[model samples]
Target: MKTRKAKEQIVKELKEKFEKASLVILTNFDGMTVAESNKLRRSLKEVGAEYKVVKNTLMRYAYPGTPVEQIKDAFTGPTGIVFAFDDIVAAAKALKEFFEEKDSKLKFKAAVVEGKVADVEMIKQLASLPGREELLGQLAFTLKYPVNAVAWSLDNLFQKLVTVLENVKAEKESA
Candidate 1:
């Protein structure tokens, strides 16, 4: 049994973590082996995320005044939380892929992101999204494409004009 002071310290730490995290995923890792759990942790770490197993009671206490409180009921049953300080989609994708590959009995319960409680399917959809850097790169490329195309077209048009003028000069000289 935990002492009251220890429980209070845990709740305080959990609250701080909940506040910093962009996304909090609740999962049940009932049947996952130790190796499998370690593998999942490693995968999460690669993307600057961490996973923790917390008591449901402590979680409920920690989330009472935050957006996470919206999904308080989801804190039940062998709960593990995967969270990231920066990229939500990266963490989600990592966890989703890990679950898919391991085929473990663990299941995603719910998630809280951007002040909303996301459903299971929404969590999966979020996971499918590309990471922050990839999305930014795609956006930058998309934004630059039109300018590049216009430049190319203008160069082609200038070349064609030059060609036509040379032909005219040649014809006059020949005439």
Candidate 2:
């Protein structure tokens, strides 16, 4: 049993984390073994995320007056939340892969992503989104495509004009 001071400190920390996190994914890790839990924690860490098992009461106390209060009911059961600070999509994808690989041992609950309350299906959609770098790369490619096409067209036009000029020069020389 934790002392009152310790619990207060924990609640304070949880509140701070909730405020800092861009994505907060709630899961029911009721049947997870220690090894599985550690593995999941490590996986989340690799993507700049951390997982915590919090008491519903503590979560409620910490999340009051915050955007997370919207999903206060989700804190029931054995709640394990992943706080994603760096890349929300990467963390969600990681959790989704873990969920699939574990055969649904880690049950999906609800999530607060970018201050939006996401249901189970919405969480799945969030997980399916491409990672930050992938999305940025795709955007870069998309932005570059028109520029590349224009450059290619200009080169083609220049070549055509050069060919026409050469044909005229040759014709003039022969004449």
Candidate 3:
């Protein structure tokens, strides 16, 4: 039983979090135990995501002017919001893995990712996709590949030139 001031503060915090979040996933935490909830929160936190169980009324008030506002109906049920401020895929992947690892009754209602609404299937696809660090590593490798190839080609050409010069010098010495 929170006071009016405390509820207002909660709304303020929700608004700020919603504003900053890149992906806001609405979860139905119907039968989650306290231990399971704590585990979920910790796992989400590990991947730069936050799980908040705010009241639907508070969320509705905070939803205005945010991307998640369009899916207002999702606020219904035992709603919990998973805010992925950094990388959407990583957060989705983390949640999906948790679902697989446990007999999780926490159902994902939907996600507003980058202002686009993603359905349950879409979220699953997102979870299957590579995470932020993995994607970045791939991008770095892709960017470095051509540069490395060119450097290797140049080194090979220089080595050939050096060999030719050495052969010529040896011939001159013999002459």
Candidate 4:
């Protein structure tokens, strides 16, 4: 029962969300209660994701010209949208955990990640991946490990040369 002005405002907000999100997930909240949805929202918020149960029409309006527009056809049924601006894996993990914990009625409808339409299985796979910080830490280790090893190797070679020089000096002094 929203007026035209209110609906327009909502569409505008959705547009902004779509612009910012790197991961856009659509879900069907067919049997979920208000309390359950709010709990899910809180869980998503902890990981910096926004969740909204949107009217398909408004979502469709917001979708066109946006990266998530590729999945506009998925806006059927009780569509719930999750917008993850950063750390898509963390958001996916939060959602998957909530789904597992409550055995909730949330069903994955579709996903558009990084401007590409992705399969529902992608969400599952993303959930299994480590968070952004962990991935960055792992990448840093991978990038720097060889450099550290080379530095250590050089230091070890120098130590051996120094030891050999010392041994030669000792031999010469004795002779």
Clashes of each: 0, 0, 0, 0
Instruction: Tell me, by TM-score, which candidate is best.
Output: 3
Per-prediction TM-score, please?
0.87, 0.88, 0.90, 0.85
Candidate 3, residue 107: CA error in Å? 0.8
Per-residue CA lDDT of model 1 for 28-126, tens digit only, reads 999999998998999999999999998998888899788788888887789999878898899988887877773777788888888788887787898
What tens digits encode model 2's per-residue C-alpha lDDT throughout 66-174?
7788888888889998999889888888888898893557988888888998876776788788888999999999999999999999999999999999999999999
lDDT of 1: 0.88
Cα error of candidate 4 at position 79, Å = 1.5
Ten-residue stretch with the least lDDT total in model 1: 97-106
Show where candidate 3 strays beyond 4 Å: 170-175
Tens digits of per-residue lDDT, candidate 4, 1-175, equal 9999999999999999998899998999998989989999999999999998888888888988898888778888899999999889999999888767746898888888888888877888989998999989999999999999999999999999999999999999999
lDDT against the true structure, each candidate: 0.88, 0.89, 0.90, 0.90
Q: After superposition, how far is residue 119 of candidate 4 from its true place, in Å?
A: 2.3
Sort by TM-score, best first.
3, 2, 1, 4
Relative to the unseen true structure, what is the C-alpha lDDT of residue 120 in candidate 4, on a scale of 0 to 100? 72
lDDT for position 8 in model 2: 100
Better of 3 and 4 by TM-score: 3
